[model samples]
Target: MSTYSSNQEQFMYQTIIKWITDDRWMMDILRNVRSLSLPDSWVCAGFVRSKIWDQLHQIEPRTPLTDIDVVYYDATDLDKKTEKVWEQQLSRIQPELPWSVKNEARMHIVNGIAPYDSTVDAISYFPETATALGVRLDEQDQLILVAPCGLTDVFEMNIRVNPHFLQGRGDMETYTQRIQQKNWQHTWDRLTVVDS
Candidate 1:
C-alpha cells in the first residue's frame, strides 16, 4: 500500500518536474549526463532532494552541492576505473562542477547486498526516503523521476529512514551515523526528522 494517494503523488511529480525545468543549470547538468549515453542512468540523491528543500526553504542563490552524483546500471562492465573515467569526462565538460559517477552494478559488493535489478532498484535501498529520489532527462528532454519510496516524505520535508535500511538488510548504526553526519536539519530548518 502507498503511504500517499495517487493524486498527491502526481502533484509532487509535476511540481518537481516544473522546478527542474525552470532551473537552467540543472537542465544543463542533465544534458551532460545524457551525453554519456549510459543505460538507465540518473542524477540521484542530494542533487534532486536539495533543490526541493532549497525551494521550500525559500532560500536564494541555491545551496551548492558537495558533489553531483551520477548513477547508472551496466551489468556488462562493473569496473570501478570506468566510473572514474566517466567522472573525469564530466569534469572535463564542466570544470567547476563536482561530479561523482558510479556504476550501480558493482555497488552491491560495497553495500554487502545482492546485486540490484536496475539503477532504480539500487536507489530504493538508499538510507533515507528523501535521498532515494532520482531524476533523468529522456530523449524528448522531459524529466523522468524514479521514486521507489514515493515523494511524500520529500514534498512534506519529512526525513524518514527507508524501510530497506530498517529491515535486517541494512544496519541501524550506519543509518544513525549518516543522519548525524549529514546534519540536514541544521540546513533545512523546516525539516522534520522521523525516528522509527
Candidate 2:
C-alpha cells in the first residue's frame, strides 16, 4: 500500500512546487545542488522541511540550516568514503553552504536496516514524516518534490515517527532520541510531536 493516496500526493506536490518556484533562494540552492551531477540526487530532508515550517510559522526563512542534506543513489559505488568526495564537490560549488552528501545505497548499514533501493526509499524511512521530503530540479529545470510520507504532518506542523522506522526496537529508540534532541517546539512554538 502507498503511504499517501493519489489526491493527497498531488496536493503535496503542488504545494511544494509553488513554494520552491516562488522562492529564489530555494531555486538557487536546488540549481547548485543539481550542478553536482550525482546520479538520482536530490536536496532533501530539512532542506525542504525547515522552509515549510518557517513559512507556516510566519517566521523568517533565514533560520540557519542544520545541514543541507544532498542525497543520491549510486549502487556501483557504495563506499561511505565517497560521500565525502561529493560533499567536497558540493562545497566547491557553494563554498559558504554547510553541505552534507549521503549515498543512500550504503546507508542501510549505518542505520542497521536493509539496503535502500533509491534516494526516495531512504527518505521514506527518515525519522520524521516532515523531514522525509526531497526536491530536485530536472534537466529542464522542472522542480520535482518526492514525499513518500506525504505533506499532512508538515502542513499541519506535526512531527511524527515514520512507520518504516517503527519496525525495529533500535530504530524506535533512535527516533525517540532524535525527537528529544531536536526540541523543535522550542523554536516553532506551534509544533506538535506525536510519538505514539
Candidate 3:
C-alpha cells in the first residue's frame, strides 16, 4: 500500500507506471464497454485534452499521459426519457474496471486548485502525465458528449477522447494569455514545491 504524501516521485515509481501498462486490466474495460453507449449530451475532460497540452508543451520536453480530466461541452443535455440507464451501463462494466465510479457530474469543474491550474480545471498539475479531455461520438461521426446515462443515482456516461477537437486550436490561447499576465516564473518561485 502507498502512503502518498509529498513524495510524488516515490508514488509514481511504485504506482502510476504499473497501472498505465496493465494491458489485461485495460482490455477488460475496453471489452465490457464495447457494447456500452455514449452520452450524446456530455463531453469528456481527460485524455484528448492531455494530448493537445502535450503537443504544446513538448517545447519543454515530451510529457507523458496519466490522469485524464473531462467535462461536458454543453452541460445540460440529458433529462427526459431515461430510466435506470446509467445503472444498466455501469453495472454491466463496473466489475471489469479497476477504478470505481463515483459522482457523475455533468461537468467536472476544474477550478484551478494550484500547481495544476494549467487549464480551467487545473489539469496540468498531474505529476507523471498530461491532463486529457474526452467526448462521445455518434455513429455518423457526430458528438454525443453530454447525454444522460443510467438512473439519477447511478448515471454514468461513457465518452471518447476527442483528438480532432484538441488538434484544431494548438496554442490554447485563452489559458496562455492568463498565464502570461500572471508571471508564472515568479509564481513558481513562491510555490512550496517546484521543479529545478
Relative to the true structure, candidate 2 reaches a TM of: 0.91
- The deviation in Å at residue 31 for candidate 1 is 0.3
Worst 10 residues of 2 by lDDT: 1-10
* Candidate models: Cα lDDT each: 0.90, 0.84, 0.29
lDDT of 2 by residue, 1-196 (tens): 1355578766766877897789998899899888878999999999899888888888874667878999999999988889998888778877888988988898888878778888888888887888888999999999988888778889888999888767622467778888899888988899988866
TM-score for each prediction? 0.95, 0.91, 0.27
Candidate 3 lDDT over residue span 1-196, tens digit each: 1122336434433332233224243334333433344322222333333223333233233233232222212234333223235434655656332222212222123222222111222221221112232233344543322111111110111122223223322233533453356342342232121111
Ordered by TM-score, highest first, the candidates read 1, 2, 3
User: Which clashing pairs does model 1 show?
Assistant: none
Q: Which pairs of residues collide in model 2? A: none
Q: List ranges where model 2 is wrong by over 4 Å.
A: 1-9, 168-170
Question: Which ten contiguous residues of candidate 3 have the minimum total lDDT?
Answer: 147-156
Comparing 2 and 3 on TM-score, the stronger one = 2
- Between candidates 1 and 3, the one scoring higher on TM-score is 1
**Model 3 bad stretches (over 4 Å):** 1-22, 39-88, 94-105, 108-196
Give Cα distance to truth, residue 172, candidate 3, Å: 21
Which should have the higher lDDT, number 1 or number 2? 1
Off by over 4 Å in 1: 1-5
Evaluation by TM-score, superior candidate among 1 and 2: 1
